[model samples]
Target: MATDGPNLASTYEYVIVGGGIGGITLAARLHARLPEASILVLEAGSDPSTHELATSASTVSAVRSNADLTWQLPIEPCKGLGNRSSIAQVGKGLSGSGAVNSAAWTRGPACDYDLWAHSVGDQGWSYESLLPYFKATECVRGMKINEDHHGYEGLIHVVPVKANWAKRTYPLRKAVQEAWAQSGVDYIEDGNAGDPLGLTELVEAWDEGKRQLPSKSFDLEGVDIVTDTLVHRVTFTQDQGHEPRAKGVELISGQHINATKEVIVSAGVYHTPKILILSGIGDPQTLVAHSIPLVHGNPEVGNNLRDHLSVALTWKLKHPEIGLALGSPLLTDPSYANGAPLDFIQFGRVPTNLHTEMLLTSKEDKALVLRPKACHTESILLYTYMGPHMSGVNVPMDGTYITTVTANLAPTSRGHVSIHSKDPQQPPKIDVNANDTEVDRHILREGLRNISKVLHETPSGQSFIDSQVPPEGYPVLLPDSKDEAYDVRIRDFGFTLDHPMGTAAMGKVVDASCRVIGVNGLRVVDASVFPVPIAAHIQVAVYALAARAADLIAKEQ
Candidate 1:
């Protein structure tokens, strides 16, 4: 069962590389549709069932830190980010990042999808076109859900912060809501229901409190799941004046598996492009630089990389005995031990126009950001002192502080995922240009300023926040802080939100059908194919996307 896929057939109907979320989910659905078809899934990571730390929210860092379970790739220094280098890591297990990420099941605004369709020149990628797939993927049980937009019959279960029966509450739940409202952000019933702006209850892809692994949730009972197997590159059968046809994949260990029908690559953002490039199907210049033989030359294969970047503000609470933070007596209760600590996520545009700000953004990118119903910022309220610390504020083991990590959801800064070697075993060169554009910097600065104003001036804020832990040389923020101060802060300490995509974008590399251009019998179905940045945590979108890809693949057959 481990060696042979679907049967003992030497050639499979579908050969899937990287048994991560997208690969596993697609295989499960395809198997359900065509029970007799031969499908092979190759994963370079361990089986998630044996990964003990993947079940709960508390061990997320432990899972990511486990070298055996994750690919901790070093990022190249970005000049835009004050020349600071950071890590770009993701899960290497069968479930991939879905097994390691904080399981927030959020769907970005409908406009995000609509804009993607417009950019990619395909109506099928629109929100209305993809709505059925979204409904097909989730069994939403939130308290205030609109039945018209949610589905009760799906594999993954979604629960909002105001969930009726889940029986869990945070100490700062009500206060945090009131404080954000005091800052003029309104309440929205369901953020997943097309409208993503304003403050909304936090939601998660949860089972009571346990994390849901995609490899387990989608039901791949009889499918062959090969683990710890690295795919080196795709072997193709090509002829002159014809698109190269993918024959099969060659493993890094020099083992080759034949694919009779198609080869699907879902190795994710960081590694997917590396596989394509290693297959000699990328930019001519890059191939020449790495001394790889060129089969198909497309410059966009590993370009246009983007991710969510954030700057966090830490607030020292007045009363530690109240037990509002983590490490408090409140966590002793079993209900509080599961899922994420925060209760709500606040999203909105920058408070003011950037007329006074310096020149920023390409004309096309700027228009989409300023478009109607597109949110530019997301503020995550962590119930503990999880610091993106500028001052490096340290507290006791007691609960005395909380953090707000406000991220630029629609960043204009673009980076690339390039390779310096011909070997796929070596990780790709990842350069994330954080806070590079003036537009990105302006949005983040104003977002921090807005939240800071809320905690510093609002009546509700006075109830909970004692004071902000300041950066060095400043006793307080606002009056002392300047444009250069925050710019310096962002360059010094801005961190990636760990959501990377668009390396193999739809409009550039693949068509709307997810088929790679200038090649046949090869498709990429993963977050790397996302043409634009979706403004929410990508967990829900990825699950729903694989469902869409499976449907498209099945219909073609």
Candidate 2:
């Protein structure tokens, strides 16, 4: 129920801030593990299952501009993007970003999680340790699930794109596959098998033609959910012989709810660290500047922020009937060949020659170089116009355009999320130093060129392309341009794919179990705790992390 004013219950065994995927999942798991424990979940937004803008799968468009469903938080003017500022579309309701995001379910390469485990000095954070949780969280449907690699009974249902799901045949599907094959990328049988290399059919968190938001899928029966309650800061109790403990959370209404055992912060990438800093658990200088007393001095709380930067290339289709639009019947039918539409995604590394040149020439770029064994770029085929509307480019609404969204999955340019004011309601200042390093620009340039080659140079891809509609001043073909021209074009068109992570980093701010380093009874379980950004869409990782976190918390209890 919606809890407002000062009448909130004073005590609970656990208090979770932000009822997003992480919070809701943790609460459900906690309830399952500790049947009698009283759990409280405070959400800043309304419950997603009942919210008007959150009910429909097509609400992805409305959620971006709807203030009631999203934070619509703006970032500081990024110097890398020609001093341009952009709004971060973060879901505000119980389901969080999962409710509004394109339900593409992707688990990145095994090495990505292995690297995280090594970086954090925790074997529990390794891929093998997290695999069970990953399997347990997904109930594979429609697609062929490798029995050894997938679970039969899970909370979220994963649906693969079937031919019947297409309103009409994606005339270019075969051509695109042929193009990727021509470009030397192999077809991956399963993208969720910890090896997301080459071309693969897109998997989504869908069931019966509807998006399964975590708030609706997971069971939160035993948890006391308090909606429309903004947690101002975490309340702490310091004992002379022990580390400071999180006693409870103070609401924006000045009401305090006690957490007898522990408090967990799952307020997402930006707000997670923002709450920590507001609670005096961040950099001492920041707390002092806000005239807030310091509880713990963790300078890394709001630092080391990272996100996937994407660039779009749109092409006019020769046949409009072959393309899928937003309201196509093929998209909303579960009985369709697969369950969803628009499959086909490719993950590849930038050319070795460019990698070598960057390593030899620039120190900054050298640090940002894509590891030879790692996949640094993701190219996904879309049957509809997919460029960011904020880019000032008019996307064709006549349904004759197809776009290729290429993203720098492994970006080296680190940014941060810092609080601008002491008010908890004020959004954090986000600075995702996108395209700052030469390596990022170089990767995007190569990625754009690679996709262009697949769609234009290859025989099958070229057969379907009627014409191209590049942004103003952008080169007709990226590969033909000089490095300077490519860099300018990248800076002009680059935008966030909304996969942000590493603000309250694991190795730095929290432990392997996601417990905050210098505090007792306070842990962070969300995207903010990731040591680095994963190569895949983050929702899958968040599910695995939350499941693991729930197990860890249960063991400790």
Whole-model lDDT values for every prediction: 0.81, 0.81
Model 2 whole-model lDDT (C-alpha atoms): 0.81
Give each prediction's root-mean-square deviation over alpha carbons: 2.3, 2.8
Estimate, for each residue in 369-445, the C-alpha lDDT of model 1 and write its tens digit: 77878888898777777743332556654678777788889888888898978867788988887787888887787
Q: 244, model 2: CA deviation in Å? A: 1.4
Clashes of 1: 0
TM-score of each: 0.95, 0.94
TM-score of 1: 0.95
Query: What's the C-alpha lDDT at position 385 in model 2?
Result: 79
Candidate 1 Cα outliers beyond 4 Å, as residue runs: 1-9, 142-144, 164-166, 323-327, 351-363, 387-391, 473-475
lDDT of 2 by residue, 424-494 (tens): 88999899888877667777888888888887777777778887777775657645667777677667778
Q: Clashing residue pairs, candidate 1?
A: none
